[model samples]
Target chain A: MAVIQRSRADKTGIVIRYVVLAVGALLFLLPFYLLVRNGLATEQDITSPSWKLFPSSLQWSNIAELFNNPAVPMLRSLINSLVIAVVQTVGVLVISGLAGYGLARIPFRYANAVFYFIVATLLIPAAVTFVPSFVLVSSLGWVSTLRGLIIPGLFQAFATFLFRQYFLNFPRELEEAAALDGTAYWGTFWRIVVPNSKGFIAAIATITFIGSWNAFLWPLVIAPDQSAWTVQIALSTFLTAQTIDLPQLFIAATIAILPLVVMFVFLQRWIVAGVERSGISE
Target chain B: MSTVTTRLRGRHDRNLWFLIFVGPFVLGLVVFVYIPILWSIWLSFFDAHNTVTPANFVGLGNYVDMLADSAFRSSLITFVVFALFIVPTTFVASLGLALLVNRARFAKTFFRSVFFLPTACSYVVASLIWKLSIFSGVRFGLMNTVLGWFGIEPIAWLSVTQPPWYWLVIVTARMWLQAGFYMILFLAGLQRIAPSLYEAAAIDGATGWKVLRFLTLPQLRATSTAVLLLLLINAFQAFDEFYNLLSSSGQYPPYARPPLVYLYYAALGQGQDFGHGSAGAVILTLLIALVALGQGRFLGLGRRED
Candidate 1:
């Protein structure tokens, strides 16, 4: 009888857990559902007093309307954003990877000093240097240029720190075997370390790409011209316009988020692992 | 003699290789980060406006003016209130989500992914959605629509300050955007706790809240401290959402102005006072450093758990 009572209680507990989780899931997903629903709705459907979860008919043309809208320059902004994110990701990977490997493996006289200096840079908030960096970039005539967008952001101290921590645990035997085979340090790194570190590299690449793609403040300040605007900047333009077309704005937002959502769906494992590593690595 | 010389040459080569590997990154950091920081400090001492290069020297004038300015002072208070509310709120939410998701027996990954999906969305997109659709003042807005079912009148969410319903919009938007990321952090911390401790607790007749208080929360100290520090810093650095949500027609409302937004107006926006902005930036930087140091000491960060 006691065994049956315990089993019954366990069943109820499981049911309660499922019920709570279902409610939470719906709450989390509501905004995303609304995003798609409104994106395909007519302006009347959006602003109508009587709310409906779905529009009478889906307006797929809202996507075209957003793209063709002259003021937003959506196509140009999208292209710029793509170029910037790719370049910045590649740049951060190469620069931070080299520095991280050296700091981890090389027993040079000033290795600790160099590592500490780089780590100290992490504590200096970006806000302190925002104005001066802008001034410096503008003085170099880099305003509205891709170089302006990509070059200054290439050296990320946090990425370097993460890479160093990762490499410190890497098997020295692999590199030692390469050294014994007469591979130069550079060759050994490129040929052995880089190939073996693909997982970590992918993790960092996803993070850097997402960060650069979502970056708003620096791009907002650096690329003031409409021609040089990133997709984020382009999105902001809609809000500041004299009138906001609700459907078109929703369509644009949906477009802006689509790539990231796809990337998350595909690469979420690496993204989660990378974020976990960052939290606990210290 | 030849053997000794070869050994020395090898040592020299190793040093050279180190420099080669690390040189470009260190150089970039110096040029981009260090120089910019020093230049900002130097600029703070001068009356720089509309130009990067300034000749008019005013020692401590900008700093004094920034400290005295009502708007600048108020922005600091805004940061304090924001941090006070958001840090604890996000901490609890993230911890709660982590506990739930961790305890889930079925479709664990599904629930985790659903909660974390919003982290991939940009602050800009989230702000736009919050400002326009969810919190829109009209009766048709999602919040208002739900309220109508209960016979409550449609409230102008963002504009009104007396009740400060805008805080609801701002805080909820940020919570949705960020809570998931921190949940992942807490999940990691939870995973690191050894299962033996839980078994021991169960043997001791401890279950539910007792096990949580005695075994779980204490073990999560390091993660909790790190999360709090990160949340505080991020709160201090808030600009994108506030600027996007509150600002209309290139003008930001004075009520919700954080330091970064205020500085943007002073330097980059209409005011164009770079000196004052730099001074404010320096002050904010120092404040952050002080807080980080104090928090680290208080929490015994990086100390060995065992």
Candidate 2:
């Protein structure tokens, strides 16, 4: 905690810190730089014997071509993914937020029981249910539809657990104050409880949105048809082939992930703070 | 829930709310998860020919036969080997990266963000990067393109696993995707360590290795345990990349795909061999349970429920 240390100790620590950080940063940045560079470069650059991270001339057409590639509906897929991601995020936040409040604040009997049951479900892998989920979606005629995609993800026990953890640490007097003003449980939940949970809600929503956006297996299983596919499903179809163009897949891969990365930048600092704090005692 | 005053001796309709919050997931699980799982189990014991006709039960014969199959043994071994290499290496690399980022005085957010960029990428995107650039198995591939500097001929990276090069492909893809995620977890753990601990170490002349060894390592036991368990779980769930990358041609390296991919191929890729696929699924569930139990025992994960 001292601002000043022995000159020798200070010198050694600074060198050690910067050198390790530079190497670590490079390890993280290289792959991403390659992915983005590959997407922007021309076929000649990609196929060239000599590698260059910087390109001679920017080929800006890859983005246009990526969207226009009728083989994949890039714009529509984005719209589809956006609609699904937003709606699912909102729905899950409300449901899990309320559930989290009830579990953490209400202190009712079977609160722990309900919590344990939901948490147990977390350990069950989706692959085990692959067949039946497919059959159920198909049976309900919801397969290959956005409804099918959005509904299943709306319920997340981990999200509930997250909100509950934050709620437990919250000072209880806010709810008590609202109650003294004649606020009902539901009224207090919507007003005082939710507004106060802005940071936690944002963290939960970001996590849920990312999960929904990156989802592949369920989307692939339920909507294999190109017309109904999310961009993730569409990008994966490039793989079910004899020979794949590496650059094109790189372009598509970049396209599929760019939006989420943008969203992540806005929320990473807060989410990391929240998730780390949650893990402090867990 | 009713007011605590009247509700002190009474129960809120707790299951109703639990159902509202967890109902969707549970309903989805039962309709989607439980039924399929139980069906798979029941179907595994039957000669279910992907037909509408009734499946005739054949007792434990399917389990008996799968246990004797060499392909089953090899795929199981492949999963185990992949886990062994990927888990410890990824954990160490991620934790090391976390410490570096944590200690850096400048641009900590930028470094953390860059480190985590890959984790947000979809598996298909990541897999395609490996497939087209590095594992293209052609002269144009990146690895070969790079090796051209040394005057070595193009080597087919994906197919030529006389050295099990497919494992390399799998590991490379995994490291790129996972290292950032575990880095976040480690950074989180790093923040929780009290500054006093480090200061105490400093007073004892524990500035570098001595401080790290005495302070950081001992303080990180639980986090390390969680990391180990999570890494193992993630490794065990290796489907997205393997499924996407497994070469349709015979160019696939020997023992390239894991049990899940093989199960997918069996159930859907080939003619419906649900019985075999179901058996594989059963084996996977059991394997996951066993591993969880082992880790729980080793880490004492839930022992001190504060």
Candidate 3:
């Protein structure tokens, strides 16, 4: 009798759990739904008191209008954003991967000290470097240029530390076999280590790409010129009081965030796994 | 083939390896992060206005001035208030979401990804969506539309500051954007807890609430502490959403200004007092350091465990 009662209770429990979760999911997804819905709505439709979740007419022209918004240079800014994210990701992977491999694999005097220094940098608040980094970049005439956006952020201490931690736990037999076969350390890394670390690389690259794409404050400070602005910086210009073009702004925001949404959908597994791996380090 | 020559060659190879492996990142770190931090500290001591270099040496003047300035003081207060509101609420929300997601027997990935999708979004895009489409101070805004179903009148969700209803917009937007990431963190923490502990407690006649309190919560202490510390740090660094949402009208409202936004205004906005900005930055850093150090003290961050 008790077992039968407990089974019935478990069935209802599962039902209750799903019901609650479905509601929570709706709450979480409401903004994105509104973004897409309103992006397809006209300014008249958006501002009208009558409410509809779906737009009566899809404003496909809004996309064209956003891209051609002369004041913002949406296309140019998108290209700039792409370049910054791609270049920054590749640069960080190479720099951090190599430094991480060295710190973990190579036995050198002061390696631990160097590792500690890199980790120490992680503790310092980013605000400390904000103004001075701008000054340093400005002094070098990098403001309003991709060089300013890309170079200053190329080496991430956290990414390097992540790579080091990953490498520390990596099995050493493969590397040992390579060494026995007369392969050098760098060659072994390029041939064996790099190939084996595809998952880690993908995880880190995805995160770095997302972060670089979404970066605001640094780019906001350095790239005020429309020509040099990233997509995010360009998107913010729509919110300026004088030019509150609602439809155009919604469409532009859709364009800005679309890549990330798509990427998250496809690469969801690695991103989650990557974060788990990093969390384990703590 | 002499011993000394062989030793010299070995040393040369090791040095070459070091140079080839670690040189680029160390060089970038030194130039970009370390030196600039030191320069910022130096710049804080002088009356450097708009320029990196100073014409006058004013020790403690900038810090004192910033403290005395009402705008800066109020901005700091706003930051604390904002953090206080965000940190605990997100902790509960994420923890709740984590537990719910973990309990699911099906579509776990679907629920997890749906919740986490917001974490991938740019604050700029999210803020614009909230400002223009959702909390828009209009009768047609999303929230207003829902409220209308309840026979309520149109309310200005973003503009009402006397009761600070704008906080609803700010807090919800931030919570929506961040809660998912923390949920992921908590989910990771939850999975790390061994299943045997729950089974063992159940065998001992402990049911749902008791098993959770005894088995789960105790195991989650480390992850929970880390999550809180991270939330605290990220809260103090708040700028993107607050700036984009509240200051969409071009000028920041006094009610919603956080330290970073305020310092931006003081130094780069009309005031152009770079030294004052650096001083504010230093003070903010110290506050962050204090929080980090206090957390680290109990967490034993500086200790060598291995």
In Å, residue B54's CA in model 2 sits off its true spot by 3.9
For residues A1-282, what per-residue lDDT tens digits would candidate 3 score against the true structure? 999999999899889999999999999898888887778889888888787878889999999887776776889999999999999999999999999888777767777787778777777767545777887888899999999999998989888888877787778898888766666767889999999999999999988898899999999888978889999988887775666778787788888888989989999888887766554456
Candidate 3 displacement at residue B244 in angstroms? 0.5
Best by TM-score: 1
The whole-model lDDT of each prediction reads 0.86, 0.72, 0.83
Candidate 3 residue-wise lDDT at A6: 97
DockQ leader = 3
State the displacement of the C-alpha of residue A33, model 3, in Å, after optimal TM-score superposition: 1.3
Give lDDT tens digits, candidate 1, residues A1-282. 987998898788778877877898898888888888889999999999988888999999999888887877889988999999999999999999999898888779988888778877777777557888898898899989889999999989888888888888889899989876677678888999999999999889988999899998889888999889999998887775658888988888888889989988999999998888766665
lDDT of 2 by residue, A31-134 (tens): 66777788888888887766676866776788887777777677777778888899989987877777777767664566676676666655656665565455
> Which pairs in model 3 have colliding backbones?
none
Per-residue accuracy of model 1 over B194-271 as CA lDDT, tens digit each: 999999998897967899998999999989988988899889999889988887777677788888888888889866
lDDT, model 1, position B294: 76
| lDDT, model 1, position A257 | 87
Ranking of predictions according to TM-score: 1, 3, 2
Q: In order of the candidates, what TM-score does chain B achieve?
A: 0.94, 0.88, 0.92
Estimated TM-score for each candidate: 0.96, 0.89, 0.95
Clashes of each: 0, 1, 0
- The CAPRI classification for model 3 reads as medium
* Candidate 2, superposed: residue stretches over 4 Å from native: A1-13, A243-247, A274-281, B1-29, B51-53, B248-254, B297-306
